[model samples]
Target: MRNFKKYWSFVLLFFSAFSVFSQDVQFTQFYANPLYLSPSFTGGIVGYRVAANYRNQWTFVPGTFNTFSVSWDHNSPAFRSGFGVMAMRDQAGDGNLANTRMGVLYSYDIEPFPDWHLRPGLAFFLQQISIDFSKLIFSDQLTSTPMPPTSVTQPGKDAVWDIDVSSSILAYSDNMWLGVTWDHMLKPVATFYDDNSRLPHKITVHGGYRYITKGFLLSRIEESFTVAFNYRVQDIYRQLDLGLYFYSQPISFGVWWRGLPKNSVGRRVDALAFMVGYKWEQVSMGYSYDFTISRLGLASGGSHEISMIYEFRLTPKKRWKAIPCPTF
Candidate 1:
């Protein structure tokens, strides 16, 4: 029992201390998790919007990996701006390595060209991270076979805090949108140790286009086909997601491919995700199941994700012209 714990715990710490660990958690339904995708999406809605997301990954792995995020954004018609707040938490490994973040965003609306709308945004965030050193068993701690005679002092601190900056821009037209985001501008130190290792910079480029037809065979039903993709890079790690969605009235379905790597060590074709969504009035919800295509295989129990969103108006105010974008 002691041998099992020691070997596994050290493995967890070793990988986490290196750059192999992703500093930020990922979501399968990128369109559903708007704020986490880009700061410019903060208030980029017809009205006030609230969204929540949850993901569970690698059930077959020794430890658990879970991530959750919630955010709120309000598009002020009078100011023609977007304001939002987001909070997220990710916990992984048996030692319970965890990262939690909170952020506030503000975006201003601009029109660089005639029919295109540009939204530029800025965000300030604080992060807190922790790892359980008591669970880790080092070489010095193991004198003989079973364990050490005396208790080993904890290796790392209980928790560490840091502040960071991020920015994003969204450019959109009637049926198309393009967005880019940059994170970890300050490259804050992430480890519990006294060393100088810092967080790597991350950039994401995402866009989508929708082809709409007013009515289907049924007069009340509307039909549309949409294609979207996201390309993200953090240090040497890169990921790509391409998806196609078909919308018929209140229901929508989509398929996405995650990974599509760039010859990187840790980045490989990871999963294929199937998603379904429904919307009624101001409320919407989405669910996705990821089929692991990586070396982990189906033994990982794949992954599951769900998102909920609500958009509404608080008071009757003069509305600004809205840019057309996908609801999910």
Candidate 2:
């Protein structure tokens, strides 16, 4: 057990050298947290919404990764606008390296044709990255009993703050939708040290199509199948998630394969995710498990995620065209 702790500590210390090349926290149930997925998805529904998400990655490993997020959004049909606010925090490893962000976003809805809608969105965020040097074990300290403090020089400040911007556009009809997002548009500086290391811009292309096999009494979606894909590129890293969803009334199930199959040079295959969800009246909830297939293998205990959303109307009698995206 002591050797295990020492092993992870050393691994964390090694990765800390490349801290500037950070990646965003990921969730298997992308649409479950609409605002996080894309600002254009803000207020995509007929009413206001509140959502929360939590993810724990590599549970078998000590202090591997934990992330949490919450968001609120409102759709104003009269104004053809969507407004939202979101907050997220991610913590990694025993060193307590963490990132936090709070942001506000807005989207304008335009109806170009009878059943087609286009939306453009913008978001602004305040981001902070911090690390606790006290928790980290240095190489010299690991070799002895009653380990002495690390000889490494702590940074003058423990945290760095920056401002960031993101933009997105989405187009949708009654059964299909496509969207694109560019994040870190301002190329925010993210390093704790004086060296100018800016957060790299990330591009995402995401879309899906829904096939309704059966309808409810009110002509709403009942039994259906959805096919979706999300592709993302940041710096030199690339990932793709292709998934299928099946829904029948209150129950939904999804299966996803994450990673590029063609890339054999590195860890091309990440995980296979399985998800289950339930919707009751105004509330919806989802849970997913990632079966790690990378070199980390099953010993990593994969990952677990849970999400919840509640929707309500600010006014009693307002209607809007719903974006044709999967709810979970």
Candidate 3:
């Protein structure tokens, strides 16, 4: 009975998450996971940049979801373009429902004016998703001791693999920027079931404006503040995120609100997030935590994310100028 109870409990939580989140994995620190947000960010770094990120969600739930990603990109002055590659994985539930992906990215930088520029990017990726059937016990997975003999367990195959493409474009200046991305260009049909269930294409639009104050923090460096907004839609779900950030040389602080106001209940408010970061020469690190505000409340265990990035030059190659963009 104890085993049965535990099994059912996990099944409930797992399906609940599946219904709410569906296929795509989301990041609270969107800026930290640049490549995941859009391919245009590929090679946005000056010379060469490498970055890694990790996220743990719903701390209170046993076997909750976790995601990790790594990427490397470089700017090419000769080609007037940039390229990169990225890998990511996500796992959830006691059944270990897993998704893994590898992708290649490319972007072209166009200067329309002295301080204004446009970057259009493209990405191609291959993905695989699978769930451990043995770890899951459906309503049919019960004892024969009683009238409910239909509860006997059975196993089934639930795996999918596919290739997808995405594209993005950005317009930026010294103090403001805007961009849009469209993912899952083919609308890949992937599901555990025998029939095809098309994964909805995802679209994200974002923009921000920054203001710098002379000598506000350090005599040699300036203090700056930025207001950012992001809106994303995938299938039937949509989210809007707004953030305010302050930066001074090597350090940054930010607060954000993530929500879907149209939804009823606590799920609509989602979370309020806080972040802090530091940069020293070639390396930078950032951390963030979300405070749950919706119905899930503290039971959601909130969310935590951390990231590290390094920028370097392999040799004294001619450096390609990069467009100024948000650092979130």
Off by over 4 Å in 3: 1-23, 142-158, 215-222, 261-267, 314-321
Per residue, candidate 1 scores C-alpha lDDT tens digits across 155-244 of 456888999899999998767999999999998767776767678999999999888876632223377888899998888678889888
Is candidate 1 or 2 superior in TM-score?
2
lDDT of 3 by residue, 1-328 (tens): 7567557755664564355336488887787778888888888776899999999988898878899999999987677788999999988878788778899999988989977778999999998877776676455435444534334333365677889899999888777889999999987655565555666888999888878775521223356788988888887788889999887778989999998858523356788999998876778789999999978889989899998989995543643445444454
- Runs off by more than 4 Å, candidate 2: 1-14, 17-21, 216-218, 261-265, 314-319
In terms of TM-score, the best-performing candidate is: 2
For every model shown, what is its TM-score relative to the native structure? Answer: 0.88, 0.92, 0.86
Q: Mind sharing the TM-score for model 3?
A: 0.86
TM-score of 1: 0.88
Candidate 3 lDDT: 0.78
Cα miss at 253, model 1 (Å)? Answer: 0.6
Number of the candidate with higher TM-score, 2 or 3: 2
| Candidate 2 C-alpha lDDT tens digits along 1-328 | 5566656655555467355345677789989988888999988877899999999999999878899999999998778899999999989888788889999999999989988999999999999888888787677677779997655556798888899999999999888999999999988766667777788898989999998899842346778899999998877678899999998889999999998647533577899999999987788899999999998998999999999999995553644578888855
Rate residue 101 of model 1 by lDDT.
88
